[model samples]
Target: MELTVGPNQFFWPAEKWSAFYRDLAEAPVDRVVLGELVCSKRLPFYQDCIPEALAALTEAGKEAVLTSLALVTLNRERKLTADLAAMGVTVEVNDLTALAHLPKGLGFHVGPLVNVYNEGTLAWLASLGAKRICLPPEMPLASVETLARAGAGLGVAIEVWGHGRLPLAISGRCYHARLHKRTKDNCQFACEDDPDGLEVRTLDGQPFMAMNGVQTLSDSYACADYQIEALAAVGVAALRLSPQSQGFFRLCQSYRERLNGTSPAGTIASEVLRRLPGTRLSDGFLTGPSGVSWSAAPAIP
Candidate 1:
């Protein structure tokens, strides 16, 4: 399956952001989705550097797609989505609100954050010019296989969340603000401190969730190392790798190697465990009762 790096989910510095794309240009990946998918306010900080990063990735013969904001409420955000059409790049719609602003008959992409559950929704979106779809991470394998089959008939490529922390929910409340006892409007940028996201634990200190400014993710990264064949067997077009602050480009290369059968699944899992330190991997969404279960043994290759 092809690999497409999702937009960075954290508030990393501009130089780090640019450097990640620079590294990705040389990485063995087919596509890259770049742009801020979280809070719209964070865009202005590094907006100037996106064009150079886009150019670099294109020059490397990689297909780059721009991502619209996951939550768009303000006029500025609406304008941002509208202006994306003029960027002359493929736009990945993270929110349905963006479709309202898109110019007529322009093809767009559907990001994983958008709700594309049933065949009806999928068909409707394909009619609206969605050439590709990254199904929501929360979807079960049965739903995924069904969607993948239907998508193929519609001439739409279907992708799935292959790895990374599960983005469970997005909220209007800025948790970083609540943690520091500040309101959303006047709060300082507290989320910048946690590059991966601030870990939230239960009362007993068991890690449960991760909190970004307005996004909530699972503490453990969702991995599909063992289920690659299962997904690929059912016609999944690609796998999306969400960008983390550390060792992300290496992470992409590892997956690429594993997909090509040049490396083992355990090798990729071990590579992640080596770098992240005690970070658990889950494929429950694709194989278990829920989106948090792990397999005890590797699936047969």
Candidate 2:
């Protein structure tokens, strides 16, 4: 299976963002998704860097795709989405509203942010020139298997959230701003401090969730260690690894080694959290009854 780096989900500084893509172009990854996926307001700060990054990835022989914002409510966001289709690269639709702006027969990509819970949505998206889909993190293995089977017949490639801080929810208000007692407009980009995200503790002081602007993610990084074989058996095209603040190039190399049969998933799993610190790994969303269950190695079937 290929390692496709998902979009950066955090609000990073412009130089850091630029540097990440530069390093990514040299990583052992097959695809690199570049663009802002969380907040549309943060886009302008690093928008100019996209063209250069896109060129770098393409020049390095990687398949690059532009990701639409997960939530697009304003006119500027709508315009941005409209302009994305004209960039000459494949568009990865995180929001369904993007489909309205995409041209017919162009074969756009579906990101994990879209609510593709069942086969019907998969088939419908496939019919609309969707070439590939990264299934939502909440889907169980049973549903993934079924969708992968249906996708094969539709000539569409299926991918899953192989690794990342599971994006649990999105809201209109910026939680980071609220935490700092500031409005979204005047809040000075406070979310950039935590490259991954600020951990949200429970009432009992458990690391329950993470806050990044308007997006809420799981405190644990979602790792699909034991399910790779099952995913491959069901004809999965690739495994997505989300970009973290540090050790991401090394992270990509590890996943590449795992796919090539030279590295153990356990070792790679251990290496990832070593650099990112204070986060557990979970495959429960793929195997357990709920998204919060913690399992190191989950039963695929």
Candidate 3:
């Protein structure tokens, strides 16, 4: 199966953002989707670096696609969505508003944030010129199998969210600002302080969610270490790995090794845990009773 690196969701300094993509151009991934997928306000901070980054990825022999903002409400944001299609790169639609702006018959991609829960939606998107669709992270494996099968007939490649903090929701209001007693407009970009997003704890101090400006994410990182084979067996074409703040290039190599069958899934999972020590990992949304549940390593047959 092919591996794709999704857009960066955090608010990193311009240098850090540029370096991430520059490093990714050499990472062991097939395709790289770059551009601002979170708050549009963060775009200006690193927009200038995008062209060079895209060129680097292209020169390095990787398919580079630009991603639409997950929520486009402002006029400039709408214009940004409209202009992405003209950039001469594949546009990954994270919000449906982008569809209205894409030129007719122009093939595009769908990001995991969009609600692609059923085959009908998948087929409809394919009909509208979506060449590839990354099923939402919350989808169960059975639904994934059904869609993958349908996509096969329609000639559209099906992908799934293989890793990263699950993006649960996006809002017009910035939760990070609200947490700091500021309004969305003048919130001073407080979300940048926590590059990976601030951890939200429950009353009893249980980790619940992560706040990244307007986006709400699961505290536990969603992993597909155990489901790679099952998904490949189901005809899923690719796996998307969302860009995180740390060890991402190595993370790409790890997933690539697992996909190539050079490394066992258990070893990859253990390495991830060892490298990202305090983080919890889960694949329950794909094969469990809850999104936070982690299936134990399968016994060797």
Best by lDDT: 3
Clashes of 3: 0
Q: List model 2 lDDT by residue over 119-183, tens digit each.
A: 89988998899989999988888888999898899988889998889888889899999999999
Residue 142, candidate 3: how far off, in angstroms?
0.8
Name model 3 segments beyond 4 Å from true: 297-301
Candidate 3 positional error at 217, Å: 0.1
Full candidate order by lDDT, most accurate first: 3, 1, 2
In candidate 3, list every pair of residues with a backbone clash.
Answer: none
Full-model lDDT, candidate 3:
0.92
- How would you encode candidate 3's per-residue C-alpha lDDT over 83-123 as one tens digit per residue? 89889999999999999999999999999988988888888
lDDT of 1 by residue, 118-176 (tens): 89999999999999999999888899999999999999999999889888788988999
lDDT scores of the candidates, listed in order: 0.90, 0.88, 0.92
On the 0 to 100 scale, the lDDT of residue 86 in model 3 is 83
Q: What are the TM-scores, per candidate, against the unseen true structure?
A: 0.97, 0.95, 0.97
Ranking by TM-score: 3, 1, 2
